[model samples]
Target: MTEEVNNSAPDNSRRNFIKTTALAAAGFMIVPRHVLGGKGFLAPSDRLQVAGIGVGGKGESDLTGVFSSGKSDIAFLCDVDDRRAANSVKRFPQAKYYKDYREMLDKDAKNIDAVVISTPDHNHAMQAMAAMQLGKHVYVQKPLTHDIYEARALTEAAKKYKVVTQMGNQGASGEGVRKLQDWLDAGLIGKVHTVYCWTNRPVWPQGIQWPATGGNIPPELDWDLWLGSAPYKPYVEKLVPFNWRGWWDYGTGAIGDMGCHLVEPPFRILGLDTPVSVECSVGSVYVDEFKRGYFPESCPPSSHVIMTFEKTNKTKGNLQMHWMDGGIKPERPEELLPNESFGDNGTLFIGTKGKMLCDTYGANPRLLPLTKNASDRTRPKAKRVPGDVEGHYTQWAEAAIAGYGKIELSSPFEIAGPLTETLLIANLAIRGIDVQRPNANGKGVSYPGRDMKLLWDKQNLRVTNFDEVNQFVKREYRQGWSLGV
Candidate 1:
């Protein structure tokens, strides 16, 4: 299914360039993807040509899902780390390889039909934006972008660019969410008023200071490219491969990593929106016997964030959502027997009548009471996504090849964007949990923002109560990297 790359200037270069320039000057028009083809639109039989950025780890899985769909070909692979890309390269030897996505997109945009991004949180926006501007369909990893502004921008861009888009919260395609919604539809749980989502994440380091000494850079890794959009920092050993999830510059803490998976069920089931108010209490770490570790650069070891959302159609009143991470689990419901599992990563819904819960990826959904099993009358009302979670890739590929509005997706940017915004907002509250304040008594320190309830102005993307933490709303990109571009 691989197509030969257009090494020379194609006849459509001028037209393509004109379209792209116009998009940059005034966002983009909502032109259909099939507009390139005459009449009957794009054929459903056509294969989607996919290019992958960050083609390692989760990125590899995403590409594999696309290939496994039997309706797409993996045409290009890009990654910052050759070591990490080795498996995908071996798997898709016919696919052309590149180390920098910017280079790949610039040289091969015409050859690519869609782009999949699974890089660290910081790089998601820039790479996805580049692809979208080129009129390429995009499937970005969960928590969509590193910051709130990026999330909003990408959300709008999907509409403006008129391209098919999906965020890699594959859980949205799972039957678990459908089952949960069925229970809600059946009134089994009544009206959900409160929700709790938790995960035993941050198996990596957090609440710790950066290493005093930088480590040797891995030969296969492009350190600078890997730090795209994030401020430069010398290489450190454990930070590579995965531990980056714990740091602020690269990761969005544990919540950013798992919240998209765990919190999504509640967000979808409850139809939640931006939180009006948020407050947080985080677990601290101590570097010495004197004081608690205040590694402002790292996320807290654990946290409990409480956000209140205005009532939605699915909710009865103001919705209270609690997020817990770092092995923090909520009190087990009385219906759950001592032997029953509460799950390592899960979401729970508290309704006016009873409560229901599920594991990560919205799996293993169950109602309250140790014996409350699904009866004949408790059939699924919502249709389950075909092929379950992995279908997320095929869904996007087909929609891209078939044009906009062709197929319904589980976690499209429209849905994933708001979900990501909520999670990032929660991060703002977490980041502010211990911001140091200027104390007149300079003997030691003071946390004026400690335990403060942050009032989020979604339209402005700021913490109204604590202004200092608002800086995180849309962080400044490092020199040479721009999300707008």
Candidate 2:
């Protein structure tokens, strides 16, 4: 029900900048693998120079992981909030710092061989796109982007710009996903038809109204820049550092936060694509005993979303994928032992021949029925990243050094983007559940979009029968912000 339109960036100049930079970077500035052949031939100075945007929290950890790989130099850091960047700045004392990412990219484009982005969902597409347009390889934290259009655009841009790209769903690099694949391939699970992924997230507040009054902006934060692409609004307590996940403008809610981590396994195992249909049922909060409140601005407290994808060669029939979040979970599989624990964050796959379960990041995968044959069926046939999950960062850093397509990436945009689109498409149904219309007799409000299966036309990116929810497919950015698609 809310829309913001501000498309005022100078088109010609931006396109020219991207084109010129991409042509100049037809080859990587980072030393290729051949240049690092032997111990004596490669100097410490030959490491790829990586600049990090939004270097705090996960960003700090991502940068550390890259540097720890022993293949990259942490050359620059950028974040709008000085407070959040403090830990990363101290950690990388030699790295130059900038408050604005655009400033950082503008000044250091030539010096940086690659960039890592761990900003909030809203800023992800723009920052990553800008880095790619400048012909730098990129590593972005997952859910890829806030919207489906952004995901698709970033996917295509990675190929067009000829840059190495990785989304931070480190789970994609985990052995668990590989094990599940091996089990499936070994004919242990037959063919996967249904998947249930659940999480106890939105640990932050949701299903509430925005604050009616604005508070004083914090000294350490740049409010304007933090609201990049999102409509400008006055500051509110506890929105920064975290908690932005609940708001539609800044985040894609729980699914966005954890879908990349949990849903990724199924996407890879099943070889799924954009969902053909999505349906949802959400938990509601009551203002009083008699009244239930609908807060469209925020995500619901709990949701159970089901998405269907047409049959692929790997799937036996149409695939039915279920996503539950905000503490909701699927029924315990009967095959699971009564005494065994169902992980708070985990995935369950019900295949025609058998079943399998796993924990977050696709770790701890085990065949169901609490039987010995589950673990006995398969040995790994797939390649693994050296450090397993932690290797996700180094994989990208090494790939950046190796140049595009020289090395394989586990969660490159081509894969992660489509996976992200599935999650966001499910979100369309989640958000649509709250869509309001004039009640009969125009007395008040009614949820016209609830409890109905929503059909998706992937070709056009629309809700074929439900026009109201199509607005979310691609959001209108604030003035001066665009995906530059």
Candidate 3:
């Protein structure tokens, strides 16, 4: 959404505090709003009065982007952590604050035209669905849902509410990513046969030794609220503020954390739908040692998930998509020189005639043809694609303020829902009972693994494996917190 200053500042001191605290917290050089606010289209006169849920961590960044876009008023901020919410209170003193997003939505439903949700994976579907049900546009961070059923429910909710929506896969709007799509469309890399996407997540909270016996919950945080819809458990410090990434109940581990960014490009450009089968080859390490009482006796810390898409009548050919986590690397693409290596995180598309490699976040993609002569310095420079990765936030703000029709949404639910579904399948595969074995074609050759790879009936939004993975596709919600269909 566009970030335009509302000329009507109800509280000058409060506005100043927001600007100053945000600058200090960001630890970046600050520019005055007026000076930084160069002439650009302002948000519509009927700008959205926006509220931010989960206003810590990523939520702060999301807030700054929306405010800067000049299209919305930061009417309220919500977070499970009181300390984090205090920061928002310092900045937007005039805005209301709440510990529970449900309270904020209930109290300010009339005033909040839109909501930006930067909460944990488990909370996304419920929050976004609630906002949509109330007729508020939503901009939710990706992967859009913690599970597959929520993904479908969210897409339907967006349509039913007829609200403008955007998934926070900011990379989807990157100029470089779009260029990668164009290159594929232009046949720069012929008939992509397989794709390998990797990420260096768990960097902040990954691979921790499971928490030892429990301790008292910290007073500053409300451990119960933090638990939210996840099963109730005693508070643990490692699971809070940041460490949630490693846990199964509250987070999606490496796959859900980075897949939206690393895997989206290929999933989009390749027009991948439901996979014919899915399975994971997990690391031997048990997850219990890392965090206390988080993972059940079941679950692993790291895995290599192989998802195969049979040649649908519409697909050009059978395509194999492999996903790796925990600093794993794919077998080197043949096109790269013997010594070449991809970034710690990124996607590699192996085509029939060549290969295309790009950064983990879809920056600096290049086409490597099968034949590269030593004298090929004479080869023309690869075409350049311009982008403003920062512009995506602005794009969402503009769309929210302009009432949907006037502005284009970069990653609407139509695109993001399936993307999230595909990524979440990898999470399910990793937790599945069977470790997928590789077949003659190097595709996943395992049982229960195939159970998670349900045939996706896009038109009907149902899985063919109704008896197996369907239960995992969606989850049961705690009472009073359930998201309705």
Candidate 4:
């Protein structure tokens, strides 16, 4: 499958009109606010009207978080599966419901001031691009996009459309990241050199084969629509609602599932960009006494990937980042005592001066050896989010109300895009391991992508040495679906 990147300029008449109208509304509000009510009063119309796509599970929680901020209203709810959307539908009965997000945006564009997307990985780019084309502020869930190309596109689209965009890596807004940043800035952990981020995910099934028999389609589910942008396939049992994470077509494997939450802090603290090179080795499942199971369609049970990044302002030299998943972890630092937990899922930053580690979402950060740490280490230096992690939702809503470029978001597309690309690049190495080709002698197969460091051409978005793996960079969408870049 091949994809052609669209480079034609997008029409901006609607965006310009919206900006003009907003300016006029601001002019009207400037004079009436003092006379209409006392200080700090907000009329109902002032509340941001938010539309939610994929309003189930994480989607439901995302809308709930925005609503709890008291600065937004759930104006519309959309989901492909009615059964999955029941709770959200009951909670926001007043909001319009739709099985198709395209129909929702088409009809209610004017009513919606923003869009919150918590869809499966494959659909994120298309859904977000559609909303942004209509000038809607978007808050996309973590990992941002399913592919490296899509992540880069959305990052650029956020700027092109002048939308207030935030990726749902809520940990970026937590006190722990700020604390970690402060330590780095204050030279507590001098110049971070090597970092390790690990997760025990695939808590769902992985390293398995696709079910041979297609399951009966549920009455409330639209299997075709659910496969948006992905190649059409029969409804596989248990792939919906969750288990899609392990599949190559619908999900981006464990790294895509948890890397955004795990790798985000080090990405931010170090201000890293695209990596220079990446290499990985994955664990194989056994099918018999001698042969190993080969299921290229799914992610491996475990993987240890190393990515090398050029020196950023925070580092003295090139940095190496190791990512391990499926219950894998790096060597425990000697300074850490035996009793203290190294955490099942966390990030460890090794610096010239000292070492610091934090749990998932950058929570519970601490320097090595609890006994030697000084009380002054926790001194406040970095700014804190109003409500820490929960504040991520409100910050985006308030920023949208304040208009583009008004307020800073912790995981805005500017930061999230590259961070996402970093993880996806690691995945490239993982997937490359499975790339099979006929041998030069035409008798057996050769896995050229294995046991070698894949050089990256960041500007071109391809693996320089291993061309076979580039196919995973930008996927070919199904008919009628386009990123429309």
CA lDDT of each prediction against the hidden true structure: 0.86, 0.88, 0.72, 0.90
TM-score of every prediction relative to native: 0.90, 0.90, 0.79, 0.91
Per-residue lDDT tens digits for candidate 1, residues 353-407, read 9988888899888888747774526877798888898887778877887788778
Error of 3 at 472 (Å): 1.7
Q: How high is the lDDT of residue 264 in model 2?
A: 92
List all candidate RMSDs to the true structure: 9.9, 13.3, 12.2, 11.7
- Shift in Å, residue 6, candidate 4: 66
Lowest-sum lDDT 10-residue window in model 4: 1-10
In candidate 1, position 478 carries an lDDT of 98
Q: Per-residue lDDT for 163 in model 2?
A: 90
Better of 1 and 4 by lDDT: 4
Task: Kindly indicate the candidate among 1 and 3 with the higher TM-score.
Answer: 1
Worst 10 residues of 2 by lDDT: 36-45
Q: What would the per-residue lDDT of candidate 4 be over residues 72-145, giving only the tens digit for each residue?
A: 98989999999989999999989999999999988877677789999999999999999998888999998799
* Model 3: lDDT to the true structure: 0.72
Tens-digit lDDT track of model 3 for 1-485 = 12344544557768899999998756433433223222221223456578898887788888877787776688888888877767767877888888888888787776677899998888899889888887788889877988888898888777777778888877887766776776676666678888898876667554445566787876777777777777776776556677776776777878888888888888877877766667667665443667332233233556788887766332359888888887788887666777666578899887766677888558877777435333233332333222367677778777766664566666789889888878877666665544334577877454455344445555554456534545566777766578766
How many residue-pair clashes does candidate 4 contain? Answer: 0
Candidate with the greatest lDDT versus the true structure: 4
